[model samples]
Target: MSSAHITFDTTGDKIARRVRKMRSSAVRDLFAAATRDDVISLSGGMPAVSLLPVEDVRAATLAAVESPEARAVSLQYGPTNGAPGLRAVLADMMRDLGIRVKPDQILVTTGAQEALSLIAEAFIDPGDIIITEGPTYLGALQAFSAFEPDVRAIPFDDEGMRMDLLEEELKRIGKGNPRLKYCYVIPNFQNPGGVTMVAERRRRLLELAREYDFMVVEDDPYGRLRYDGGHQVPLKAMDENVIYLGTISKMLGPGLRTGWIAAPESVLARINLVKQGADLCGSSFDQIIVEHYFKDIPWQKTLQKFVAVYKERRDTMLAALEEFFPPEATWTHPEGGMFLWITLPDYMDTDSMLAEALEAGVTYVPGNSFFPDGKTGRNSMRVNFSFETPESITEAIRRLAKVIEDRLELYRVFIEAGALPGYDRKEAAMTDEKTPTPWEEVVADSEQNEEAVMQAREGNAEQIDIAEEAVRDAQQAAAPAEEAAE
Candidate 1:
């Protein structure tokens, strides 16, 4: 809720209005469970860091500090923007994507995550509006929410963010509205929702940006990790003014934490000033290592190895989904991305099922993490293939499938007892209605059929091992979702 709309009573110290708007990353919260050996985590888009040879990593670090002069440069504080030679190397890398930018225009950020926060700080003010894909990146939402912008999410199809929908939204907001700031998009292999923005949508989006008078921010972290399919043209390649964010986090290694932003000099200048205050400068040590890694070695061959492994894992997950998931469930088959999205039945409520999933020995990010409201995408979840083995990926899907089936079976029990307003089990499963079953009514109705519900469960030998407690938890969790829909 916006602080402007209501006075939230704080217990002790007053929290900043901007801080109150901030949201924690849900994926980060899953790490505790992900660390457990018993759980198969399909939560993070973690790169396969194991694919890189240990010797290569050691060589990169040693090369960065090979001599006294190199050590001095690596350890000491460097330029606020970045080391010029490092920026030059990043520029040459960008050239591969058909983007031309001078090293002077590129501002090296701690990581693309820092670039996200810096952009928000520089451009967004309270009540300002920014556009993103309907289910955009969770990290980006966390960064933007701190500034309290009205994040308008435009829905996307397989080709990507619907330009027609964007046009309609723009008209509704009015052309040249000063409140409308910039549009943020991950053009290739988008996070959470693994659909790429097609070339036609790209051209139309840029054209609309000019007509509407707002800048475009392109965050391309997954562009280089393509498993198969040809690359789509980057937004920055078409427009010189677009703010382009790139990183070595996916390719070289996330531990390096190095990324850069290329924008118009005016915009870069403002962000550079903001960056200096955030951290004196990003680790000069990390920057030195990144420079040596990309500039000194054959990085492309290692990236191909990463791609091949990801492709096999992706195939494994896809086959598992087809074999195990229910008919009511559907998923995205991405051409080249680390994660795929699974959308369950309208009433399945993925957020409400997370507890059950944890108990089932697999963890996934409920789709609510991707949206600003945190409750709108309750029927979907994001699954990752880049972090786990092919065997683990297959087993994780099987476990996840059981969780979905358990929920569906519970709903069927309610319908059978006249607790839910559906004709039968098949009708209820296929229903497109958004309204959830009434909690109070279902509880009241369940008393009379408690014996029958239990009996039905005991008779089904193949049912997932969802205990009474798990079933109750799922049903109770829906109350808040019911309120959100209202």
Candidate 2:
């Protein structure tokens, strides 16, 4: 007798509930678009790896593996926390950032990315409340999301996350909320936003963390790469309650995948337990290479080179934006770090315009993805300056500007035709709301209005003529008002 053929269908039922809720990274999607030869990408917080000290790295690799003793150590399984020597080195590095921690307190992970994941695993449970800056690091959002945390995003300004708003949120969360996990922040040259937390605010943040009995995770991947202005002390420097994360990805090559978490030993112990079940340990070989590089090579010189090259690229992008962007567009002038934020006219949705931007030979990460709730920053984008050369950066900005100009012109037409009621460029620019009308709705309204106008023109010439005359008068009347508002 022939056995009956059997097949099992494992659709959504087999997937974890948390995994089902996770969204794909918008920056990764833009990065894929950028892989095309014709598209220039200002997405992804990628360092200028071309500027890395290749000769030094090569030498370090050789030194790390030449001896039989060294090879054995690298090849063998190591401590879950990290290699002791590298942890010591990382401890010294943290001291330079004003964080005093023993080597035992440092938990070296695969990279800062894994460090973030470990923190989430150690601290967060389902339905826990995790606070972060509005438009915070997308990767951090992805990391915390896996634990099913309720992320509360507080808005930020040029200085950084607004303390007033954060304080109010904490009070609302209440001091007795056991589900409140921690406040995760990229305090130095924060990803996407590129706003540094001021020292006074940093102190206040520590004070609040203590009073509220919540930990503060200070992710400081870009702190040392300052191109201008004095350095602000890290949050960890002032408070032992702060958990500091540092990575060699920006300083050295990201391929090495070396990063460390400097926190209290008790916290490190808990994270190490979670980490063992995740990957057991990071690449033992990579940690050794990082150790040799830090010990033998002039890492500070490499950092200086990165700052010089990246600063030039940043300046080029800024200058190009000034010359090519529409009058209604505004962007941040970041002192350092890979990214700068741009805010377009409110009605313009960067996510909707991304297709047009790629068609125009440029790409950017839509700003909505950076938010915890993905509700705000519809009219914004994050642009990276470190990955592209100055010439390419200029050309990319010029291409992006054309797309913006075309979109803005379309919006103007809709306004002139009275399709968008009570919506003027000036009024839209001044208001800040948590939710705006979705771009699809706006486009649908415009299309319906345009069809109505076309039907009127074809069926009744007299009515069409009157409508055109009235539109002309409206445009003429609004010209002076727009100019006065400007």
Candidate 3:
């Protein structure tokens, strides 16, 4: 009866082969729960949109349709590259990060998300080798998965992606490999990880990219959100050839849906061709709103307010985690960002633990979702501080810690029952340092909690049950007597 019916009748799968292989980030289900008033969700990397001044945004939106001349441009289709004024504003914004770029070199898209997919479409071929941090942005993994690239992820530490390890892999891949397309990085307050790439590491990455003859794609969503750190020069600042992605989603609001790619003119030329097919051009109305927001508004003061609030939230979450989480767990100490990474005992699986967390009135993005493979980092989960109140963050951590403790109890049972075939108690300790085992501490604490709850409730349990039965009997007797009389 329709085109959809005809497609289903003709096509066996109704999906492209490449697209069929792609998988969701396993967050949509959790997001549904996150919206519930009873749940404290640490899953989404949403900014505190309530912190942005409403009057300021209202003024920006009003400016878009203020006059006939404004409506002529804002409401009409424009260049695929971007609005000229917005591009200039973006270039000026880049100047603050020491990235000098011409307006002509920028390509505006729906969001930085669209930029990622376009980059994958422009460069990636089937089975092409691409490099990213081991636990990278989940959205990037989702974007690139459509192309079926053989993703090779390198490990990272506090300083950021280990350049020494990257160099080792670069040598393994050898020089000038055509299949090695690009080295994509989120150098500043990386998603999920919350670790910044130090200046020396940034330089080393650029050097390796040069030697390997591969493009360096920098996805800097949180660069301007710094709270207490010295500046780390952007990769684009060091080398103009680096493809830098910038977004107003963090500073302004994601609802505007504006982001731009500052790349070489040659790169823009290719991507612009692809962009024409992917939406003809971005929403002109949205671009106009953004241009005025940056140009007409004193966005700096608002940005400062965001930093202060975020810093307090981040610290609150950190302090709560310190006080609540088991000693077996570890998490990154981010100077500034919306999210932080928390890893639990290796024997634990966060993906599996999520159900209990939801039941406990909290939710988090399981760490494995960030990996290119769907099944790694099973012991870790990413928590957000930006969306929740300080009190909520603290309570969420406390609930999550209980979930972890429950898992620890199960593991202890397995160990005591000798269900683990080859586990060595000493070698399997959560930490190498000498301390009380998490199993022992968790069991002891659980016992104390159980005792307290039982003492409070069990004392009156028999009497309450007897009284409830007697009331039920009385109701049953009265019902029969009243029915007989009737």
Candidate 4:
């Protein structure tokens, strides 16, 4: 069916090197597998549409269509900077996150995806250096990769990206590549990882950005979806040099395709110019619809419902992982959001596991695709728990664990039979004769984490001081209660 030698000439505007350099995202292909009846996908980072405040959106839509002013807004082309009322609403929302921005600073886009794409078009030059979390959002990677930027990933822990490693990366940027542009971060309930950068790190990161003089793109589509509790300050809140990208997709409806970016005037202007070519402006109809939706909809009530549903799902997934997953397979316990990251033993390849997982009627996004550098997260995978039911979560994890068990067993058998290299193929194999039992390895990891926690407690004298101060304040307020108890 294939010819060995074929000469074909293609002439009309050949693919540019920058476009050619970019690769199709591995995660994008996941949707096809996800749609199958056999597969219970933990792969897609999609919010459940059934959970959205559809009635509220419908009410707003009817009101918008009926009103003369709103009808005009829907019919006519709007400004590139977005509708004025929506911009004001967005500014108010930003104030809650401690980001003070005016209407002029906000440029609305089709979605957060477009905001990132336009930013990449505006700012990233070929061979420019950009930084992101080691296991970052795949959408961002796809957006920025098209610009042919030399992307580097900073290491991340449960607390978020390692600031120490980020500092070192910043130091290398100008020396290694003079056109070094900016860093992108998802500070709260980060995609794939589900780790929130603590408040202290947010301040410290701003300090580092100021010191380095490189921009920080704070991409926060899911910050508002924090199911556990209180708000974390956006990185842009502390730094004027940062660009804040936000979306209503998670909370409202992705069908609206509404997202916005808050940045300094200069950057906003440049992004607008880039926006001129890409759809000219985000749909005027959608913008007006959203503005009306925000006005008519009681978002607080919708938010409460979302919190309750997602929290239940989160609890269900965590319980399932505990019950079914092997002790060696480590997973993050996210307080909020759709995803949790899992790390298998160093010998496991998530990409290879994905094929087996699909065959077993379960699916997950391979973690390596999240990393700016492709090979770093070979042992990890991202799981989405928010979209599935409790029973589905239980069944999916059971299947996944069976797949992993079978793979490990097969690996052992291959080595024993001499079908695989005899304990020395370090390049292609992660497992060898020395691999420990799953239970023992996971137990050891747990102990190590406990020890680390104890060590941190011992070292952190300031934490104790703060706790003591809080106790003193509480005692003073509750003196009458103390006396009654005595």
Candidate 2 segments whose C-alpha is farther than 4 A from its true place? 1-9, 424-470, 473-486
Candidate closer to the true structure by TM-score (higher is better), 1 or 2: 2
Off by over 4 Å in 4: 1-13, 174-177, 412-486
Candidate ranking under TM-score, highest first, comes to: 2, 3, 1, 4
**Residue pairs in collision within model 3:** none
For 1-486, candidate 3 gives per-residue lDDT tens digits of: 565643335674777999778887666667889889999999988899999899999999999999999999999999999999999999998999899999999999999999999999999999998999989999999999999999988888998999989999999999989999999999999888999999999999988888889999999999989988698899999999999999999999998889999999999998999899998999899999999999999999999999999999999999999898877788999977788998775556688668888999999999999898887787688889998899999999999999888666545544443334444444555456434345332333333333333332346565335545654665586698889999
- Per-candidate local distance difference test: 0.85, 0.85, 0.85, 0.78
lDDT of 4 by residue, 1-486 (tens): 777887776853687777766767776788888899989988877777787666787887786678797788887888888988888888887887788999889999999999999999998888888888888998899999998888888877888989998888777664444587888998888888999898888888888766767788998887767777678877787777689999988778788889999999999999999898888877888888788777657786787787788889889888988887775578887768789999876556778668779999999988888877777777789999878888898899999999887655533433333223223323224654334334222222333433332333356555444445654665586698879899
Candidate 1, residue 432: Cα displacement in angstroms equals: 16
Q: Relative to the unseen true structure, what is the C-alpha lDDT of residue 354 in candidate 3, on a scale of 0 to 100? A: 83
TM-score for model 3?
Answer: 0.86
Clashing pairs in 2: none
Residue 404 displacement in candidate 2 (angstroms):
0.8
lDDT of 1 at 222: 91
Which predicted model would earn the best TM-score? 2
Error of 2 at 254 (Å): 1.2
Q: Residue-wise lDDT of candidate 1 within 86-173, one digit each (tens)?
A: 9999999999999999999999998999999999999999899999998999999999998999999988888999999999999998
Ranked by lDDT, top first: 3, 1, 2, 4
- Score candidate 2 by lDDT: 0.85
lDDT by residue for model 2 (335-384), tens: 88889999875566788678889899998999899987785787799999
TM-score of each candidate? 0.85, 0.88, 0.86, 0.82
Q: Lowest-lDDT window of 10 residues in candidate 1?
A: 438-447
